[model samples]
Target: MLREIDVVISTNKDLLGLETLINQIKNQSGKFEVSIIIIHQYRRVENLPKFLVDNKILYKNLAEQNLSNAKNEGIKLSRSKIMTFIDDDVSISQDYFLSSWEFLNRNNCDLMFCRINKMNSNLPLSRNMKDNSKKINYFNSSCCLSSSMWINKKENENLYFDKNIGLGAKFGSGDETDFIFSSLSLKKKIYYNSKVSMYHPEEFIGLDNSKQIYSKFFSYGMGQGALYKKHYNKNKFLCIYLYFLSLIKSVLGIFLYLFFFKLKNVIKYFALFYGKIVGFNNYKNIQ
Candidate 1:
């Protein structure tokens, strides 16, 4: 039986980390035949790894399109039983593929995810690991979704990454999470393997009580709100009302922090509230 797999890395020019990840894959043990697909806007480095260029790695350049389109292009080139997606910034643990393969093969899930380990030691544990035993409830295609996953090749025609959702790596987000939700709604299994992990390097030793980290997370939260409004099936009127209420609460939370607490926390909550409002208002524009 052929146990070949194709891994697609969505990258820009993070060669410092990319080289390490490539080596990890090359060194992993399995009867798997591997191929690489890189979707990049521009190659910042002149010389890529010789092994990657000399072997089966295929590079597709779409100078101004969104990442969803790039991901779609990579999937088109993938020729194997299983297709995996990983981010450029991640360093996979040795057992990453082994765990992914076993879970995918055993459970027959097309959309699967693994745990993430934040490189920054100061971040809380919830951001890094999922309780291994709990069943995954929804699809969230961000670092974790792309860090490790398998999609059946034959199913490609039916599943194209929505270019509209993850467009341009901008304020737009949640395409992968939305995709997983779409797949699971069709009754396909989506699995979470807590043991499969990757290391995400952030700027700080851990996200200290920094203004920058809070701002980033606030943008992330707003993106999620946009996603829920776009794809969730709950009552529309209620959803809109609740979204507004939540947005207001986040704003008030910031004010409270301003009055009697950490200044960084206030900025974080303000950014999050702003992002949610912006995201929510922009949905009409996206369509």
Candidate 2:
């Protein structure tokens, strides 16, 4: 008896959010069976919520704290044809599961990236294309956010997130992009759909916490840079184009923000620009 979808959530120290997401998943209205796989990292089993035991939702405790590793563990434990990865802090629409199933089978998609809107706001959490669905390629793969992504394991049995470039890893980002690039390299069918959406909290960038904000953005930039280097051999033109595009954007953002006396924005863009350079140079060293 195979399940229709296995929703894998890699979480740590967010029991409240985890419990809320689980309840939301339970309330999801769909004809298919959906199983939840929780990869709890850096936490003791005793710290987990009691609902997990009472409800008998499958979960595993991992001592390691790598995002990619946690997600890979979920993949290993999953027993479904379709797997969906989402962050614990986010919430999905009521039609998320059914919509994903219908879209995948209707379009014969191997992997699909859905829109991520900010909770209670019309704006999106990240840059997304128009509402229309379209094929995803290496050039516009920035929209392939992992939190709202669904994958067909039967079509991509060998696909796995890169361990060296995620949140807890040295590079600290770009795990999703690396996964998308690998799928494209294998000629997998990938699509982006706005109809299948999830809601995430807005990323806060306050004036009082400029240093922390800069550090976070810099880490993300490093991962982006490493990602470009890692896949340079696979698609030279795409890599070069994206690398220079980021460089140019960061530079422009710095000058633009500086002119308007937006010190926070200036710091963010500068850190990102410098971090990318360091990451590109230090990729081989880290490996």
Candidate 3:
């Protein structure tokens, strides 16, 4: 039987890691048939390994670096009824592929995002809301929704990730959540199942934290601003004002943390708001 679902992996600069990820997929036991498409964003893999070349996986070299661009290409090429986007460095248990299939059926949702588990203890976990409220919740970034999200392709073919945002693009992040937010605006059915999960081990090692923070948060802030401009058009003028106002908000956030004795968040709060300012200024850069 043909595979019922397609897994689109957006990755760059790591063929060995991609090899291991392929192994994990091969090792999975699932009731649903699966096919994969790897969107290599950069650095073409010359002399393909026999394991990957022999498999049913279709490989495409995308010279561009935008994560959203890779995702859009993958979605365009996907031939399954259902599709899920994942990052290359992420790993899932043997049951992950099958579980996502099950989740889509059980929830009967247009889009379903399970959970993303981080590998590091110090890093922090994405918000896990257990309530069954079923209300559309807005996400600050794609932090809560990992690449593990599952979706029905035929039902929402027009709903694609924003090309201007995400990694390798002008905007730092928010492609994942922006898709979710747009779906909500379109009044599409969305479900969140805390039980289903995807694991992404800590990869933020040997990096300069200060520089990383400055650039990443700035882009994220910009993404947020862009999201507002895209979805909340009425708020565009107000967003500009709020962008300037964030300096005050950032200072207040820092003081709030100091009051609560959570001193570490001082920089985090500052980073977040400062990034917002940077994003607000460069909102049109990606849009």
Candidate with maximal lDDT: 2
TM-score each candidate: 0.79, 0.92, 0.82
lDDT of each residue in 1-287, candidate 2, tens digit only: 43478889998775656777787787777666778888888557745567676444687888888999999998888888888998988887778888878888788888898888888765678765456788998777777788988888764355778888989888888998888888888888999987777888876623358888788889888998899999888778888899999889899999999999988779888988988887877888866
| Residue-wise C-alpha lDDT for candidate 3, range 1-287, written one tens digit per residue | 54477888877876566887788887887666678898887766555567778566888888888888898998888888888887787767788877767767766777877666675332324544342324345532233464777777546346778888777766667677678877776777777766656677643433356666555666766666565555556445644554456456667878998899864456556766766656656666545
> For model 1, what is the alpha-carbon lDDT of residue 36?
82
Q: Better model by TM-score, 1 or 2?
A: 2
**Residue 90, model 2: Cα distance from true site in angstroms:** 0.7
lDDT: which is higher, 1 or 2?
2
Q: What is the C-alpha lDDT of each candidate?
A: 0.67, 0.82, 0.68
Cα error, residue 80 of model 1, in Å, equals 1.3
Model 1 TM-score relative to the real fold: 0.79
Pairs that collide in candidate 1 are 66-168, 139-177, 141-177
Positional deviation of residue 236's Cα in model 3 after best superposition, in angstroms: 7.1
Error of 2 at 229 (Å): 0.8
